[model samples]
Target: MLDLRLAPMAGVSNLPFRLVARECGAGLLTSEEVDARALVQGNAGTRAMLRHLPAERPLAMQLLGSEPEVLAEAARILEAEGADGVDLNMGCPVPKIVAKGHGAALMRDPLGAARALRAMRKAVGVPLTIKIRGGWDERTLNAVAIARLAEDEGVSAITVHPRTRSQQYTGRAPWEVIASVVDAVAIPVIGNGDVGSHADAAAMRTATGCAAVMIGRAALGRPWIFATDAPEREARAAIVRRHCDLIQGHLPERIALVQLKKHLAWYSTGLPGAALARPRLFQARNASEVKAVFWGLW
Candidate 1:
Protein backbone atom coordinates (compact mmCIF):
# COMPACT_ATOMS: atom_id res chain seq x y z
CA MET A 1 0.00 0.00 0.00
CA LEU A 2 1.13 3.57 -0.66
CA ASP A 3 1.70 5.37 2.63
CA LEU A 4 0.79 8.99 3.31
CA ARG A 5 3.20 10.10 6.01
CA LEU A 6 3.39 13.46 7.69
CA ALA A 7 6.74 15.20 7.39
CA PRO A 8 8.63 16.00 10.58
CA MET A 9 8.35 19.75 10.53
CA ALA A 10 10.26 21.85 13.11
CA GLY A 11 7.58 23.50 15.25
CA VAL A 12 4.50 22.45 13.34
CA SER A 13 4.38 18.66 13.78
CA ASN A 14 3.88 18.66 17.55
CA LEU A 15 1.79 16.05 19.37
CA PRO A 16 -1.45 17.97 18.92
CA PHE A 17 -0.96 18.38 15.19
CA ARG A 18 0.09 14.77 14.71
CA LEU A 19 -3.03 13.55 16.45
CA VAL A 20 -5.10 15.73 14.18
CA ALA A 21 -3.25 14.46 11.11
CA ARG A 22 -3.80 10.87 12.15
CA GLU A 23 -7.48 11.52 12.70
CA CYS A 24 -7.68 12.85 9.20
CA GLY A 25 -6.16 9.66 7.76
CA ALA A 26 -2.42 10.13 7.59
CA GLY A 27 -0.80 6.67 7.53
CA LEU A 28 2.22 7.77 9.60
CA LEU A 29 2.76 10.79 11.84
CA THR A 30 6.32 11.98 12.57
CA SER A 31 7.24 14.13 15.52
CA GLU A 32 9.04 17.41 14.96
CA GLU A 33 12.83 17.21 14.74
CA VAL A 34 14.36 16.76 18.20
CA ASP A 35 18.01 17.57 18.92
CA ALA A 36 19.97 14.46 19.93
CA ARG A 37 22.42 16.38 22.11
CA ALA A 38 19.64 18.24 23.90
CA LEU A 39 17.72 15.00 24.40
CA VAL A 40 20.85 13.33 25.85
CA GLN A 41 21.43 16.30 28.15
CA GLY A 42 17.94 15.84 29.64
CA ASN A 43 16.60 19.17 28.44
CA ALA A 44 12.99 19.43 29.61
CA GLY A 45 11.88 21.12 26.40
CA THR A 46 13.62 18.52 24.28
CA ARG A 47 12.20 15.64 26.32
CA ALA A 48 8.76 17.19 26.16
CA MET A 49 8.97 17.10 22.36
CA LEU A 50 8.98 13.29 22.53
CA ARG A 51 5.67 13.04 24.37
CA HIS A 52 3.14 10.98 22.38
CA LEU A 53 -0.36 9.67 22.90
CA PRO A 54 -0.95 5.94 22.64
CA ALA A 55 -3.40 6.65 19.85
CA GLU A 56 -0.63 8.15 17.73
CA ARG A 57 1.17 4.92 17.39
CA PRO A 58 3.24 3.83 14.40
CA LEU A 59 4.97 7.13 15.11
CA ALA A 60 8.45 8.07 13.96
CA MET A 61 10.65 10.42 16.00
CA GLN A 62 13.15 12.47 14.02
CA LEU A 63 16.53 13.24 15.61
CA LEU A 64 18.94 15.92 14.46
CA GLY A 65 22.70 15.93 15.23
CA SER A 66 26.13 15.22 13.78
CA GLU A 67 27.63 13.13 16.57
CA PRO A 68 27.42 9.37 16.18
CA GLU A 69 27.49 8.51 19.89
CA VAL A 70 24.97 11.17 20.86
CA LEU A 71 22.63 10.12 18.08
CA ALA A 72 22.99 6.47 19.08
CA GLU A 73 22.14 7.27 22.68
CA ALA A 74 19.18 9.39 21.62
CA ALA A 75 17.84 6.68 19.32
CA ARG A 76 18.03 4.20 22.19
CA ILE A 77 16.09 6.61 24.38
CA LEU A 78 13.33 6.99 21.79
CA GLU A 79 13.19 3.24 21.29
CA ALA A 80 12.80 2.78 25.04
CA GLU A 81 10.10 5.46 25.05
CA GLY A 82 8.00 3.30 22.65
CA ALA A 83 8.56 5.05 19.34
CA ASP A 84 7.76 2.69 16.50
CA GLY A 85 10.60 4.08 14.38
CA VAL A 86 13.46 6.59 14.32
CA ASP A 87 14.53 8.95 11.51
CA LEU A 88 17.77 10.82 10.97
CA ASN A 89 17.30 14.37 9.69
CA MET A 90 19.78 15.09 6.89
CA GLY A 91 17.64 17.52 4.89
CA CYS A 92 17.23 20.59 7.08
CA PRO A 93 18.92 23.62 5.53
CA VAL A 94 18.96 25.99 8.47
CA PRO A 95 22.19 27.97 8.85
CA LYS A 96 22.76 27.08 12.52
CA ILE A 97 22.22 23.36 11.84
CA VAL A 98 24.61 23.42 8.86
CA ALA A 99 27.18 25.36 10.92
CA LYS A 100 27.04 22.59 13.53
CA GLY A 101 27.70 19.98 10.78
CA HIS A 102 24.22 18.55 11.26
CA GLY A 103 21.22 18.41 8.88
CA ALA A 104 22.16 18.95 5.24
CA ALA A 105 25.83 19.34 6.11
CA LEU A 106 25.96 15.57 6.63
CA MET A 107 25.09 15.26 2.96
CA ARG A 108 28.51 16.69 2.21
CA ASP A 109 30.12 13.81 4.15
CA PRO A 110 28.48 10.55 3.10
CA LEU A 111 31.00 8.59 5.17
CA GLY A 112 30.10 10.49 8.34
CA ALA A 113 26.40 10.08 7.64
CA ALA A 114 26.85 6.35 7.18
CA ARG A 115 28.79 6.16 10.46
CA ALA A 116 26.02 7.98 12.33
CA LEU A 117 23.40 5.71 10.78
CA ARG A 118 25.37 2.61 11.65
CA ALA A 119 25.79 3.72 15.27
CA MET A 120 22.09 4.48 15.63
CA ARG A 121 21.08 1.25 13.89
CA LYS A 122 23.24 -0.70 16.33
CA ALA A 123 21.71 1.09 19.31
CA VAL A 124 18.04 0.61 18.43
CA GLY A 125 15.92 -2.32 17.28
CA VAL A 126 13.30 -0.33 15.38
CA PRO A 127 12.95 0.60 11.74
CA LEU A 128 15.54 3.28 10.99
CA THR A 129 14.92 5.89 8.27
CA ILE A 130 16.43 9.09 6.87
CA LYS A 131 15.02 12.32 5.39
CA ILE A 132 17.41 14.07 3.04
CA ARG A 133 17.51 16.67 0.29
CA GLY A 134 19.06 16.34 -3.16
CA GLY A 135 22.30 17.61 -1.63
CA TRP A 136 24.07 20.62 -0.14
CA ASP A 137 23.69 22.63 -3.34
CA GLU A 138 23.20 22.39 -7.07
CA ARG A 139 26.91 21.57 -7.41
CA THR A 140 26.57 18.50 -5.16
CA LEU A 141 23.36 16.67 -5.94
CA ASN A 142 24.30 13.44 -4.21
CA ALA A 143 21.02 12.02 -2.90
CA VAL A 144 21.53 8.85 -4.94
CA ALA A 145 24.91 8.30 -3.32
CA ILE A 146 23.51 8.92 0.16
CA ALA A 147 20.46 6.71 -0.47
CA ARG A 148 22.67 3.78 -1.51
CA LEU A 149 24.90 4.37 1.52
CA ALA A 150 21.88 4.35 3.82
CA GLU A 151 20.64 1.10 2.29
CA ASP A 152 24.05 -0.53 2.87
CA GLU A 153 24.01 0.66 6.50
CA GLY A 154 20.67 -1.11 7.17
CA VAL A 155 18.33 1.82 6.75
CA SER A 156 14.73 0.66 6.28
CA ALA A 157 13.64 3.58 4.12
CA ILE A 158 14.76 6.88 2.59
CA THR A 159 12.82 10.09 1.88
CA VAL A 160 14.15 12.39 -0.82
CA HIS A 161 12.85 15.97 -0.85
CA PRO A 162 14.57 16.44 -4.23
CA ARG A 163 15.54 20.07 -3.57
CA THR A 164 19.10 21.16 -2.85
CA ARG A 165 19.85 22.90 0.47
CA SER A 166 20.35 26.17 -1.38
CA GLN A 167 16.88 25.88 -2.84
CA GLN A 168 15.36 25.54 0.60
CA TYR A 169 11.57 25.46 -0.01
CA THR A 170 11.84 27.54 -3.18
CA GLY A 171 11.93 26.38 -6.78
CA ARG A 172 10.18 23.32 -8.08
CA ALA A 173 11.40 20.04 -6.61
CA PRO A 174 13.01 18.05 -9.36
CA TRP A 175 11.14 14.73 -9.29
CA GLU A 176 13.79 13.31 -11.61
CA VAL A 177 16.24 13.27 -8.71
CA ILE A 178 13.70 11.32 -6.68
CA ALA A 179 13.32 8.87 -9.59
CA SER A 180 17.04 8.34 -9.67
CA VAL A 181 16.99 7.57 -5.94
CA VAL A 182 14.16 5.08 -6.38
CA ASP A 183 16.16 3.33 -9.07
CA ALA A 184 19.36 3.38 -6.96
CA VAL A 185 17.98 2.01 -3.68
CA ALA A 186 15.99 -1.19 -3.12
CA ILE A 187 14.35 -0.11 0.13
CA PRO A 188 11.23 2.06 0.30
CA VAL A 189 11.85 5.53 -1.13
CA ILE A 190 9.43 8.28 -0.04
CA GLY A 191 9.12 11.28 -2.33
CA ASN A 192 8.54 14.66 -0.64
CA GLY A 193 8.40 18.41 -1.44
CA ASP A 194 5.62 20.59 -2.95
CA VAL A 195 2.92 17.98 -2.45
CA GLY A 196 -0.18 20.08 -1.69
CA SER A 197 -3.13 18.03 -2.95
CA HIS A 198 -4.25 14.51 -3.76
CA ALA A 199 -3.32 15.00 -7.40
CA ASP A 200 0.13 16.22 -6.48
CA ALA A 201 0.59 13.19 -4.24
CA ALA A 202 -0.48 10.83 -7.04
CA ALA A 203 1.74 12.66 -9.50
CA MET A 204 4.77 12.33 -7.23
CA ARG A 205 4.17 8.60 -6.80
CA THR A 206 3.73 8.04 -10.55
CA ALA A 207 6.70 10.24 -11.47
CA THR A 208 9.16 8.90 -8.91
CA GLY A 209 7.95 5.28 -8.50
CA CYS A 210 8.31 5.98 -4.78
CA ALA A 211 6.69 3.83 -2.14
CA ALA A 212 5.00 6.81 -0.45
CA VAL A 213 4.39 10.56 -0.45
CA MET A 214 5.25 12.75 2.54
CA ILE A 215 3.24 15.90 3.13
CA GLY A 216 4.89 18.84 4.92
CA ARG A 217 3.86 22.52 4.73
CA ALA A 218 0.72 21.75 2.76
CA ALA A 219 -0.72 20.02 5.80
CA LEU A 220 -0.24 23.01 8.11
CA GLY A 221 -3.93 23.71 8.77
CA ARG A 222 -5.44 21.36 6.27
CA PRO A 223 -5.10 17.98 7.85
CA TRP A 224 -8.19 16.87 5.96
CA ILE A 225 -6.03 16.73 2.87
CA PHE A 226 -5.44 13.16 3.97
CA ALA A 227 -9.13 12.47 3.56
CA THR A 228 -10.86 11.92 0.23
CA ASP A 229 -13.63 14.45 0.71
CA ALA A 230 -13.15 18.02 1.88
CA PRO A 231 -15.18 18.98 4.89
CA GLU A 232 -17.88 21.62 4.89
CA ARG A 233 -17.61 24.87 6.87
CA GLU A 234 -19.35 23.44 9.93
CA ALA A 235 -17.15 20.37 9.81
CA ARG A 236 -14.09 22.52 9.35
CA ALA A 237 -14.99 24.57 12.43
CA ALA A 238 -15.52 21.36 14.34
CA ILE A 239 -12.08 20.15 13.34
CA VAL A 240 -10.58 23.43 14.41
CA ARG A 241 -12.24 23.06 17.81
CA ARG A 242 -11.09 19.50 18.09
CA HIS A 243 -7.57 20.60 17.27
CA CYS A 244 -7.68 23.28 19.98
CA ASP A 245 -8.99 20.74 22.47
CA LEU A 246 -6.16 18.42 21.59
CA ILE A 247 -3.63 21.20 22.03
CA GLN A 248 -5.12 22.17 25.38
CA GLY A 249 -5.01 18.57 26.50
CA HIS A 250 -1.31 18.31 25.70
CA LEU A 251 0.08 21.73 26.68
CA PRO A 252 -0.31 24.26 29.48
CA GLU A 253 -3.13 26.75 28.90
CA ARG A 254 -1.00 29.77 28.04
CA ILE A 255 1.33 27.91 25.77
CA ALA A 256 -1.56 26.08 24.19
CA LEU A 257 -3.30 29.34 23.45
CA VAL A 258 -0.17 30.77 21.85
CA GLN A 259 0.33 27.68 19.76
CA LEU A 260 -3.32 27.61 18.74
CA LYS A 261 -2.90 31.09 17.30
CA LYS A 262 -0.60 29.87 14.55
CA HIS A 263 -2.92 26.99 13.66
CA LEU A 264 -5.88 29.34 13.65
CA ALA A 265 -4.08 31.61 11.23
CA TRP A 266 -3.39 28.66 8.95
CA TYR A 267 -6.99 27.49 9.23
CA SER A 268 -8.25 30.89 8.26
CA THR A 269 -6.25 31.07 5.09
CA GLY A 270 -8.47 31.24 1.95
CA LEU A 271 -11.71 31.17 3.92
CA PRO A 272 -14.49 33.62 3.46
CA GLY A 273 -13.89 36.81 5.50
CA ALA A 274 -10.41 35.46 6.21
CA ALA A 275 -8.95 38.90 5.76
CA LEU A 276 -11.00 40.19 8.70
CA ALA A 277 -10.87 37.04 10.82
CA ARG A 278 -7.11 36.50 10.71
CA PRO A 279 -6.14 39.60 12.67
CA ARG A 280 -8.63 38.79 15.41
CA LEU A 281 -7.43 35.21 15.50
CA PHE A 282 -3.82 36.33 15.88
CA GLN A 283 -4.80 38.75 18.66
CA ALA A 284 -6.57 36.02 20.62
CA ARG A 285 -5.43 35.86 24.22
CA ASN A 286 -6.77 32.43 25.09
CA ALA A 287 -8.49 29.34 23.74
CA SER A 288 -11.89 30.86 24.27
CA GLU A 289 -10.92 33.82 22.10
CA VAL A 290 -9.55 31.48 19.45
CA LYS A 291 -12.80 29.52 19.46
CA ALA A 292 -14.71 32.76 19.06
CA VAL A 293 -12.72 33.55 15.92
CA PHE A 294 -13.61 30.17 14.46
CA TRP A 295 -17.23 30.56 15.47
CA GLY A 296 -17.35 33.96 13.83
CA LEU A 297 -15.83 32.55 10.68
CA TRP A 298 -18.71 30.13 10.23
Candidate 2:
Protein backbone atom coordinates (compact mmCIF):
# COMPACT_ATOMS: atom_id res chain seq x y z
CA MET A 1 0.00 0.00 0.00
CA LEU A 2 1.16 3.58 -0.59
CA ASP A 3 1.71 4.93 2.90
CA LEU A 4 0.05 8.33 3.34
CA ARG A 5 -0.21 10.13 6.68
CA LEU A 6 -1.32 13.43 8.19
CA ALA A 7 1.40 15.85 9.25
CA PRO A 8 1.18 17.48 12.65
CA MET A 9 -0.37 20.90 12.12
CA ALA A 10 -0.49 23.33 15.01
CA GLY A 11 -4.06 24.28 15.87
CA VAL A 12 -5.40 21.79 13.33
CA SER A 13 -4.38 18.19 14.08
CA ASN A 14 -6.12 17.82 17.42
CA LEU A 15 -7.83 14.56 18.35
CA PRO A 16 -11.09 15.35 16.57
CA PHE A 17 -9.36 16.14 13.29
CA ARG A 18 -6.98 13.21 13.72
CA LEU A 19 -9.91 10.85 14.13
CA VAL A 20 -11.62 12.35 11.08
CA ALA A 21 -8.46 12.05 9.01
CA ARG A 22 -7.78 8.49 10.16
CA GLU A 23 -11.35 7.51 9.31
CA CYS A 24 -10.67 8.91 5.87
CA GLY A 25 -7.65 6.56 5.47
CA ALA A 26 -4.63 8.46 6.83
CA GLY A 27 -2.16 5.72 7.82
CA LEU A 28 -0.69 7.46 10.85
CA LEU A 29 -1.71 10.78 12.39
CA THR A 30 0.41 13.10 14.53
CA SER A 31 -0.72 15.60 17.14
CA GLU A 32 -0.08 19.30 16.82
CA GLU A 33 3.22 20.49 18.29
CA VAL A 34 3.07 20.58 22.07
CA ASP A 35 5.46 22.72 24.04
CA ALA A 36 7.81 20.40 25.97
CA ARG A 37 8.51 22.82 28.80
CA ALA A 38 4.84 23.61 29.28
CA LEU A 39 3.89 19.94 29.25
CA VAL A 40 6.65 19.13 31.74
CA GLN A 41 5.45 21.97 33.96
CA GLY A 42 1.93 20.53 33.85
CA ASN A 43 0.53 23.52 31.99
CA ALA A 44 -3.17 22.87 31.37
CA GLY A 45 -3.16 24.26 27.84
CA THR A 46 -0.22 22.11 26.83
CA ARG A 47 -1.77 19.08 28.50
CA ALA A 48 -4.89 19.57 26.41
CA MET A 49 -2.85 19.13 23.23
CA LEU A 50 -2.00 15.62 24.42
CA ARG A 51 -5.62 14.49 24.56
CA HIS A 52 -6.46 11.66 22.17
CA LEU A 53 -9.52 9.56 21.55
CA PRO A 54 -9.06 5.78 21.57
CA ALA A 55 -9.78 5.74 17.89
CA GLU A 56 -6.80 8.01 17.22
CA ARG A 57 -4.34 5.49 18.59
CA PRO A 58 -1.15 4.60 16.78
CA LEU A 59 -0.72 8.36 16.97
CA ALA A 60 2.58 10.15 17.53
CA MET A 61 2.83 13.27 19.65
CA GLN A 62 5.09 16.01 18.28
CA LEU A 63 7.08 18.20 20.71
CA LEU A 64 8.65 21.61 20.23
CA GLY A 65 11.58 22.52 22.49
CA SER A 66 15.35 22.85 22.72
CA GLU A 67 16.18 21.81 26.27
CA PRO A 68 17.54 18.28 26.57
CA GLU A 69 16.28 17.46 30.07
CA VAL A 70 12.95 19.15 29.47
CA LEU A 71 12.41 17.36 26.19
CA ALA A 72 13.38 14.07 27.83
CA GLU A 73 10.87 14.56 30.64
CA ALA A 74 8.19 15.63 28.16
CA ALA A 75 8.77 12.52 26.07
CA ARG A 76 8.50 10.36 29.21
CA ILE A 77 5.20 12.03 30.09
CA LEU A 78 3.81 11.51 26.57
CA GLU A 79 4.91 7.87 26.53
CA ALA A 80 3.36 7.29 29.95
CA GLU A 81 0.16 8.81 28.63
CA GLY A 82 0.15 6.23 25.77
CA ALA A 83 1.66 8.03 22.80
CA ASP A 84 2.76 5.49 20.18
CA GLY A 85 5.73 7.64 19.15
CA VAL A 86 7.40 10.97 19.95
CA ASP A 87 8.47 13.38 17.22
CA LEU A 88 10.76 16.36 17.62
CA ASN A 89 9.73 19.48 15.73
CA MET A 90 12.80 20.65 13.88
CA GLY A 91 11.26 22.36 10.87
CA CYS A 92 8.85 25.00 12.07
CA PRO A 93 9.91 28.34 10.56
CA VAL A 94 7.83 30.66 12.67
CA PRO A 95 9.89 33.60 13.85
CA LYS A 96 9.05 33.15 17.51
CA ILE A 97 9.77 29.43 17.42
CA VAL A 98 13.12 29.84 15.68
CA ALA A 99 14.11 32.75 17.93
CA LYS A 100 13.85 30.41 20.91
CA GLY A 101 16.32 27.92 19.43
CA HIS A 102 13.48 25.48 18.82
CA GLY A 103 12.12 24.13 15.54
CA ALA A 104 14.20 24.96 12.48
CA ALA A 105 16.69 26.80 14.67
CA LEU A 106 18.01 23.39 15.63
CA MET A 107 19.07 22.95 12.06
CA ARG A 108 21.74 25.59 12.64
CA ASP A 109 23.17 23.79 15.65
CA PRO A 110 23.42 20.11 14.85
CA LEU A 111 25.32 19.21 18.03
CA GLY A 112 22.71 20.76 20.27
CA ALA A 113 19.89 19.07 18.39
CA ALA A 114 21.74 15.77 18.72
CA ARG A 115 21.90 16.19 22.48
CA ALA A 116 18.20 16.96 22.69
CA LEU A 117 17.31 13.98 20.49
CA ARG A 118 19.57 11.69 22.51
CA ALA A 119 17.96 12.71 25.76
CA MET A 120 14.47 12.20 24.43
CA ARG A 121 15.34 8.83 22.87
CA LYS A 122 16.74 7.54 26.16
CA ALA A 123 13.65 8.72 28.02
CA VAL A 124 11.08 6.80 26.00
CA GLY A 125 10.72 3.26 24.66
CA VAL A 126 8.52 4.42 21.79
CA PRO A 127 9.87 5.24 18.37
CA LEU A 128 11.56 8.65 18.17
CA THR A 129 11.10 10.57 14.93
CA ILE A 130 11.74 14.13 13.74
CA LYS A 131 10.27 16.56 11.21
CA ILE A 132 12.86 18.90 9.72
CA ARG A 133 13.17 21.46 6.95
CA GLY A 134 15.83 21.58 4.27
CA GLY A 135 17.90 23.92 6.45
CA TRP A 136 17.95 27.20 8.30
CA ASP A 137 18.29 29.03 4.96
CA GLU A 138 19.34 28.57 1.39
CA ARG A 139 23.06 28.72 2.09
CA THR A 140 22.66 26.30 4.96
CA LEU A 141 20.83 23.51 3.20
CA ASN A 142 21.98 20.72 5.50
CA ALA A 143 19.04 18.32 5.62
CA VAL A 144 21.23 15.39 4.78
CA ALA A 145 23.57 16.27 7.61
CA ILE A 146 20.71 16.46 10.06
CA ALA A 147 19.19 13.21 8.77
CA ARG A 148 22.46 11.35 9.12
CA LEU A 149 22.94 12.69 12.62
CA ALA A 150 19.36 11.82 13.58
CA GLU A 151 19.78 8.26 12.30
CA ASP A 152 22.95 7.89 14.35
CA GLU A 153 21.09 9.10 17.43
CA GLY A 154 18.49 6.30 17.13
CA VAL A 155 15.72 8.34 15.54
CA SER A 156 13.48 5.68 13.93
CA ALA A 157 12.22 7.82 11.07
CA ILE A 158 12.61 11.25 9.49
CA THR A 159 10.03 13.47 7.78
CA VAL A 160 11.59 16.04 5.50
CA HIS A 161 9.85 19.20 4.35
CA PRO A 162 12.35 20.19 1.71
CA ARG A 163 12.11 23.95 2.01
CA THR A 164 14.59 26.13 3.84
CA ARG A 165 13.52 28.38 6.69
CA SER A 166 14.19 31.38 4.51
CA GLN A 167 12.04 29.99 1.72
CA GLN A 168 9.23 29.29 4.15
CA TYR A 169 6.15 28.24 2.13
CA THR A 170 6.79 30.40 -0.94
CA GLY A 171 8.46 28.43 -3.75
CA ARG A 172 8.65 24.88 -4.93
CA ALA A 173 9.72 22.20 -2.43
CA PRO A 174 12.89 20.64 -3.74
CA TRP A 175 12.15 16.93 -4.07
CA GLU A 176 15.81 16.29 -4.71
CA VAL A 177 16.52 17.18 -1.10
CA ILE A 178 14.14 14.46 0.09
CA ALA A 179 15.86 12.02 -2.24
CA SER A 180 19.18 13.00 -0.67
CA VAL A 181 17.92 12.28 2.85
CA VAL A 182 16.57 8.91 1.76
CA ASP A 183 19.90 7.98 0.20
CA ALA A 184 21.77 9.12 3.31
CA VAL A 185 19.67 7.24 5.83
CA ALA A 186 18.83 3.55 6.17
CA ILE A 187 15.73 4.46 8.19
CA PRO A 188 12.38 5.29 6.59
CA VAL A 189 12.09 8.78 5.15
CA ILE A 190 8.71 10.46 4.89
CA GLY A 191 8.36 13.27 2.33
CA ASN A 192 6.28 16.33 3.12
CA GLY A 193 5.53 19.74 1.53
CA ASP A 194 3.70 20.83 -1.64
CA VAL A 195 1.75 17.58 -1.91
CA GLY A 196 -1.91 18.37 -2.57
CA SER A 197 -3.25 15.16 -4.07
CA HIS A 198 -2.70 11.45 -4.52
CA ALA A 199 -0.92 12.09 -7.80
CA ASP A 200 1.53 14.43 -6.05
CA ALA A 201 2.08 11.86 -3.32
CA ALA A 202 2.78 9.20 -5.91
CA ALA A 203 5.18 11.50 -7.70
CA MET A 204 7.00 12.27 -4.46
CA ARG A 205 7.40 8.56 -3.66
CA THR A 206 8.55 7.85 -7.20
CA ALA A 207 11.00 10.73 -7.26
CA THR A 208 12.40 10.41 -3.75
CA GLY A 209 11.97 6.73 -2.94
CA CYS A 210 10.42 7.83 0.34
CA ALA A 211 8.67 5.22 2.44
CA ALA A 212 5.67 7.47 3.17
CA VAL A 213 4.06 10.78 2.20
CA MET A 214 2.62 13.23 4.74
CA ILE A 215 -0.07 15.74 3.77
CA GLY A 216 -0.05 19.09 5.53
CA ARG A 217 -1.72 22.07 3.82
CA ALA A 218 -3.42 20.05 1.08
CA ALA A 219 -5.56 18.18 3.60
CA LEU A 220 -6.80 21.42 5.18
CA GLY A 221 -10.39 21.50 3.88
CA ARG A 222 -10.15 18.08 2.29
CA PRO A 223 -9.27 15.27 4.64
CA TRP A 224 -10.96 13.09 2.01
CA ILE A 225 -7.72 13.43 0.09
CA PHE A 226 -6.54 10.56 2.23
CA ALA A 227 -9.28 8.25 0.95
CA THR A 228 -8.17 5.82 -1.73
CA ASP A 229 -10.94 7.02 -4.03
CA ALA A 230 -12.51 10.46 -4.41
CA PRO A 231 -15.68 10.61 -2.35
CA GLU A 232 -18.85 11.65 -4.20
CA ARG A 233 -20.56 14.91 -3.25
CA GLU A 234 -22.94 13.19 -0.79
CA ALA A 235 -20.11 11.26 0.79
CA ARG A 236 -18.11 14.46 1.04
CA ALA A 237 -20.99 16.20 2.77
CA ALA A 238 -21.27 13.30 5.21
CA ILE A 239 -17.57 13.71 6.05
CA VAL A 240 -17.95 17.42 6.77
CA ARG A 241 -20.95 16.69 8.99
CA ARG A 242 -19.11 13.99 10.94
CA HIS A 243 -16.07 16.24 11.35
CA CYS A 244 -18.25 19.05 12.71
CA ASP A 245 -19.99 16.61 15.05
CA LEU A 246 -16.66 15.34 16.38
CA ILE A 247 -15.35 18.87 16.91
CA GLN A 248 -18.43 19.82 18.89
CA GLY A 249 -18.58 16.61 20.94
CA HIS A 250 -14.89 16.38 21.81
CA LEU A 251 -13.60 19.95 22.15
CA PRO A 252 -14.30 22.64 24.74
CA GLU A 253 -17.13 25.00 23.83
CA ARG A 254 -14.97 28.04 23.13
CA ILE A 255 -12.46 26.05 21.09
CA ALA A 256 -15.26 24.24 19.32
CA LEU A 257 -16.70 27.51 18.10
CA VAL A 258 -13.39 28.73 16.74
CA GLN A 259 -12.65 25.37 15.10
CA LEU A 260 -16.12 25.31 13.63
CA LYS A 261 -15.53 28.66 12.02
CA LYS A 262 -12.04 27.82 10.77
CA HIS A 263 -12.90 24.40 9.35
CA LEU A 264 -16.17 25.51 7.83
CA ALA A 265 -14.32 28.26 6.02
CA TRP A 266 -11.81 25.72 4.76
CA TYR A 267 -14.54 23.28 3.71
CA SER A 268 -16.19 26.02 1.72
CA THR A 269 -13.05 26.62 -0.29
CA GLY A 270 -13.68 26.52 -4.07
CA LEU A 271 -17.43 26.04 -3.67
CA PRO A 272 -19.82 28.34 -5.51
CA GLY A 273 -20.57 31.52 -3.55
CA ALA A 274 -18.02 30.49 -0.88
CA ALA A 275 -15.97 33.65 -1.19
CA LEU A 276 -19.00 35.77 -0.43
CA ALA A 277 -20.12 33.35 2.31
CA ARG A 278 -16.86 33.46 4.35
CA PRO A 279 -17.55 36.77 6.09
CA ARG A 280 -20.78 35.33 7.46
CA LEU A 281 -19.01 32.16 8.56
CA PHE A 282 -16.58 34.07 10.76
CA GLN A 283 -19.24 36.54 11.85
CA ALA A 284 -21.25 33.63 13.26
CA ARG A 285 -21.79 33.95 16.98
CA ASN A 286 -22.46 30.30 17.74
CA ALA A 287 -21.92 26.84 16.32
CA SER A 288 -25.55 26.63 15.22
CA GLU A 289 -25.25 29.91 13.35
CA VAL A 290 -21.94 28.81 11.92
CA LYS A 291 -23.33 25.52 10.64
CA ALA A 292 -26.47 27.17 9.33
CA VAL A 293 -24.45 29.67 7.34
CA PHE A 294 -22.08 26.99 5.98
CA TRP A 295 -24.80 24.46 5.19
CA GLY A 296 -26.88 27.19 3.59
CA LEU A 297 -24.00 27.85 1.24
CA TRP A 298 -23.47 24.12 0.76
What total of clashing residue pairs does each candidate reach?
A: 0, 0
lDDT of 2 by residue, 30-100 (tens): 99999999999999989988889888889999999999999999999999999999999999999999999
Compared with the true structure, what per-residue lDDT tens digits does model 1 show for residues 34-78?
999999999998999999999899999999998999999999999
Clashes of 1: 0
Model 1, position 53, has a per-residue lDDT of 93
Question: For all the candidates, what are their Cα RMSDs to the real structure?
Answer: 1.2, 0.6
TM-score of each: 0.97, 0.99
Report lDDT (Cα) of residue 71, candidate 1.
100
The TM-score that candidate 2 achieves is 0.99
lDDT of each: 0.91, 0.95
lDDT of 1: 0.91
